[model samples]
Target: MSERKKQHFINSVMSYITLSLATIIGITLISIFISFWVTELADKDAQAINLSGSMRMQTYYIGLVLERENVEAAQQAIEKLQNTWNSPLFAQQHALLQEPKQQHNLLTRHFGIAYTNWLHHTKPILMAMAKGQHKRSEIEFLLENQVLLTDALVTQFQNDAERKIVNLRTFQLLVLLITVSVGSLVFYLLKNRIERPLSQLTETAEKIGAGDFSQRVDVGGTDELTLLANTFNRMSESIANSYSKLEERVDERTRALKQHNIVLDFLFQTARNILESPNGQFDFQTTVENLSKVLGDHKLELCLFTERGEKPYLQLVSHNKAFAHCEQTNCSECRNQDSSMQALLLSRKTGFPITIGERHFGIIDLQLNNEQELPEWQHALVQSVANQFAIALSMSEQKDKENRFVMLSERTVIARELHDSLAQALSYLQIQVTRLQKSHDKQKYELQQPIIDELREGLSSAYRQLRELLTTFRLKMDEGGLQAALENTVAQLRERSNISIQLDYKLKNVPLAASEEIHLLQIVREAGQNAIHHSKGRNVLIELIQTSDNKVQLAVEDDGIGIPQTPEKFNHYGLAIMNERSRNLGGAIEVQPRSGGGTRISFTFMPSITRQPIA
Candidate 1:
């Protein structure tokens, strides 16, 4: 609304209300002033009535004195009443008392009659009393009549006052009724005109606040209330408009948030799958197939760069099951560089780098075949997915390298043991053959029985050593810890041999490293194997105990022909393998004769580690 219109509306409302109040107050005040004036006029008339009665009494008494034949008292009384009546208080001769009437006329005429009659009645009594020959009966009669007239006048005045009082009370009641009626009318008008409109505005505003933007107040009249309603309606429209836009944006954000959540779930699942792979190997084929399902129209490829014949080779494996070209690890057939990869990444295809530290192993190539424009967020999501898998890939690569290193080191150790024990024993068999040949030639075909038994013993020992070596290589500790592996080995040994085997174990729940536990269990196995195969013992005892000094002591005892006491005679492949494993375990071994005519082989290592750090 314009300022002019608003100002005019305010002025109109204020002026109407102000005029109503002013008219009501003016009428009430005028009526009240008139009532007060009428009451004062009645009071003055009552005073006039009283003064007239006093004058008549004075006349009556004056006449009484005259009747008593005291002319002087009569004169004095008459003069005193005249003096009082004509005093300055009543000196306004022009002034006349207005006679009281039963009915209200604003102001009556012939006002001087009351004063003139009152004075004239008093003059008759005074003159009659003044005569010297005046009869007592006449004076008394006159005085009694004057008293009666005076009583009648006083009664009239009292009656007039009562009537006036009644009239005033009636007028006051009328005035009160008018005031209440006017006030009620004004309140009703104000309530309907202003309060009702303001209430509507308040209700509409509350509705809008409660998210009901469709709410609008009905506008009527060209006043400030109407302008306010119009403004409120406009505000509601604006709110509704803004809310619609905001709702659209909110919906868009919600959809985007859900999409991001889906992408995040896929990435997390991919990471979990990679970590859960066997021996920490990456299962790319299943992973990419799941990815293809999530990103349905895209072709996925896992490209790995490796060296073949000292040259860089790029291996590319596509998502299609029939599209297999090269192994993920051994990419020997691939003959490609960055240009070939760049060509492989066609116009519709994008490549996210599969990186392990500084080197980019290869790209995770994606070919988007759909017509829809790929969102930048999806591309960024693909890059993030690639980033996550790159870490898993890096870990898998490191784990495989560790496994190969472990296998190579084990092979070298086995080779060293075979050369140390079996190689030397076989060479000694070559010497035995030479000695037998020399005896046959020198003793002239008289072969020594001791030499033949020695030869047969040597062959049996060599055969046993070969079988033990094979068994050593075949032995593998399972997921069940050292105790379980030990029990399993003992059970197998008992089944393989006729000797009675016994096991006494105390090392339960020992916190040993994987390598430490594996070597320790294998050491026990090799010990048991040797006792049964080489010793010809009937019974064997294997005990794994934690010593008082916090060292793990594994002992294998046999009731059999004991090992040669000399080091040279005891040097065999099984013993050699056991010594090498003990050195690797950071422990010590002792081979000695048992107390009860048996062989006792014991290896002891610290409960945790053999030694603390050098520092």
Candidate 2:
């Protein structure tokens, strides 16, 4: 049966059971109530009968006395008793009570016959006695008949009461048996239907809580509780499937991260080499040329274009023979040129300014070789790279400025030292020489001149030391700034890997403060290396952009293998680095698997260490 239909059936069945039980119970209670009422009525009727019989006996005793006033009172009491016996009250009382059967049929018949005879024979005699006109023998015979009738009626009343008591006791025992049987049945039904299932549900819950997803609920029938158990089972299965897939993804990401680490080491070595190279001169043309060669062989054209206002100019173009030449001036030339161009144009128009610490930089563009064939992951990579480049460029420039400032501050300190020591000593020595010359005592002049010469030599030495300090300070401040570090990193990535790469020649706001820019550069280098080695992606995109909230956004996207899906693998070193860098800059990292197949990592850093103000 369908789940919902089964649920309805269960509900209907439970309802029927409940209603049936309630009806039975109601009837039982009502029957007991009726029995008690009848018993009470029987007790009252028996008392009334006994009292009436006593009154009749008393009237007969009065007749035996033959006193005038006493006989009248006795007759009045007998009349009252007869009236009560024939009343509706007595009839109603008798109807509620069960009349007992006579033990001896013959004796009962005889009693009735004798009662009738006595009533006929004694009435005339009683009238004579009341009028003082009865013969003595007739009065005696009437009295004897009255006594016989009274004895028979009294015997019948006693037997009737005794029989009713026995019947009541038998009825009470029957009711007690019915009640106990019903109660036991109800208890059994409750335990089977409710308590047992509830216990099973509790056990299942405990198992799931203890991380045993393998446990399945054993449910029968279509009851609500059974349906609840089914839902629990489905949920457990779904969770297990999801975690299994997640674990697989985690394993994949781990493998990719290991490869990325290797690439980073290679990039590191390349960067060190470039930094140690002569006169800050590196082979940029060779790097781009090699990238172009590789893409050319792959039949995938790699073109670097500069977007100026509404116009785009191609800086470097590499295409296979199948590729067509298009005008770089009009964006429409690439309107149908490639999907990457579309994405690039979209990012350019909508992209916010990129900032790193106090520095803000310009936008970036990405165009693909295949215009018609754009994969979802590829699109994601484009967006991720553009954003990463925007942020990295801004931060890279800022780092340059800070490094310069630090170097300048260091030189300034040395300058202050020179003024405090060498210059002051020179002034003191000059004053001592002037005094010695003015006094002109030959021996004093000789001694003071030697001391003055020694002081002069010390002053010359101090001046030389100051000159050296200033020179060293100037050299350190002037050479190898934050921009130099970033350039070295980019050059190394291109040289070490076969991936095609290009940095916009005129990334606006080229200079940045020291710390923020360097961190941004590091973010870019790390992400780039990861993409190149781990993602196994052919192309890399690094972007530096700014957002509306006066913050810098850095994104790095690659067509590389995507991030791990498992929670355990989700906390990998690459992710950790990305997260740490973002946190250190008071930002957050968003890592999403590319729509088609890849990973996109992006982070946003506000200019100041405070939350963005509400709009």
Candidate 3:
């Protein structure tokens, strides 16, 4: 036999509930209909009993009227009795009691005999009494019998109503028993089929949550719970497989991470060794030695070309010299060597170029042993080391170029200084000497003395200016930088003269280049000296501030006799020097009368750091 398929748990529960409800409803409706029918029958039976008693009273009335010879009254009473006997209520009751299957029952047979006796014998006797014929004995006997029969029928109807009520009560008790049985069956289905499976599922889920991936649900049935159990078992199996492999995966990741850390440390140590030297220099030999330690038995060589030559001019080798292929007297000869020999040498070695951008400086070569090849990671490490060498070489070369540029600029400054100060002083002295000679030759005694006095004054002025130029040349900025240099210049000037000189330096955050600082210091000194000698000022203020447009402004203001419109008339060579220095600094110098009765020498220029480079 084929196995019967089990219904879904929900569908089974619904069907049971629906059937129980329908049965209860059917029983309730039947009970209500029977109650109504029994009530109506009882009412009819009551009416029948009331009529029988009334007929019996009518029978007594007929007998009384017949004895008095009152034929009309007796006839009226006989007609009423006949109408009541043949009424629809009595007829229906008669038909109901005459059941074919229960004809032998005592109550049914008694009712039938009483109805037949009244219709045949008792009714005919009443009709004769209504016609005034006194058949005394027959009338009396039959009327009494009719009264007895009606009494007996009334008792039977009362008994029948009582029996119907008992049957209704019995059917209600049976329905209540059926309801209780259905309810118990429903509870059994819930506990065994639905609740038990849910409890097992909850326990399995708790175990899974506690990290026991091997736990699974085992519910069985062709229902939703069965499908859920199968899916849960598969999920647990998959999780168990993954958990078993987790340690291997973690170990693999750990090894890869350790290797990465080692590579990072190696790169860091290599960079530190290459940049360890002072003054922007690199210690390539120390870096190469470190690389040899890491490479172990492998032979490593660094071959470098000259700045303007194709031949290798320098070679640095590791401790192991097992693979020294270059044995030529001159490295240039290797370039012209036999091609087959060169190919053979190249095949035995691996090389990474040491270059940055388009500039090639050198190459690093490594020779492997027989039947050995470099791993990818080791090949990448060698390439990275070569790149580090290129970066270090590039930085060193840039520092050298910057040093040469600074030297050339300083030389230019020195030449400009000599021309502006000493050369001009010598020319003036020579012109004075020529004037003295002409006066002496003309024999002009008065002109000769004044000319000699003028010559002595010119020589004294030249010597003083020469000493100032030497002081300017020897100026060096200390750690305090431009601010400190200005402060020192102000103090020296204050000591030399009884002038109140104040320095208002506002450029605390500005970064000045070496050339910018030198030119600025020289301009300030020249301007301050001019103020002391020619302006005859009581107070001088030197202000160094930055302007709103990012230009640096230096102002030397003095409350003195101010500057003349034509400063050259007073032989102000210092003004020319200040102007020259300003031009060299790429700025403009303005010597104008101050608004407050003094001279203000303002030099405005862009700071070197803020200036854009010329393309």
Best by TM-score, which number? 3
TM-score of 3: 0.72
- Tell me the lDDT of model 2 at 576: 54
- List candidate 3 stretches off by more than 4 Å: 1-189, 206-211, 242-258, 261-277, 285-305, 308-349, 367-372, 430-498, 505-522, 546-552, 568-586, 605-615
Ranking by lDDT: 3, 1, 2
Full-model lDDT for every candidate: 0.72, 0.56, 0.75
Give RMSD to native, each candidate. 8.5, 24.2, 6.1
lDDT (tens digit, per residue) of candidate 2 on 433-537: 667676575555556767667677867756754553353333322256645555666677788789876553223433445556656765676577667657777
Return the TM-score for each candidate structure: 0.61, 0.42, 0.72
Pairs of residues clashing in candidate 1:
none
Candidate 1's displacement at residue 154, Å, is 3.1
506-603, model 3: which lDDT tens digit per residue?
A: 99878998778888898999888888888887999999998888889999999999888787655456777678789988887898899988899899
Q: Cα lDDT of model 1 overall? A: 0.72
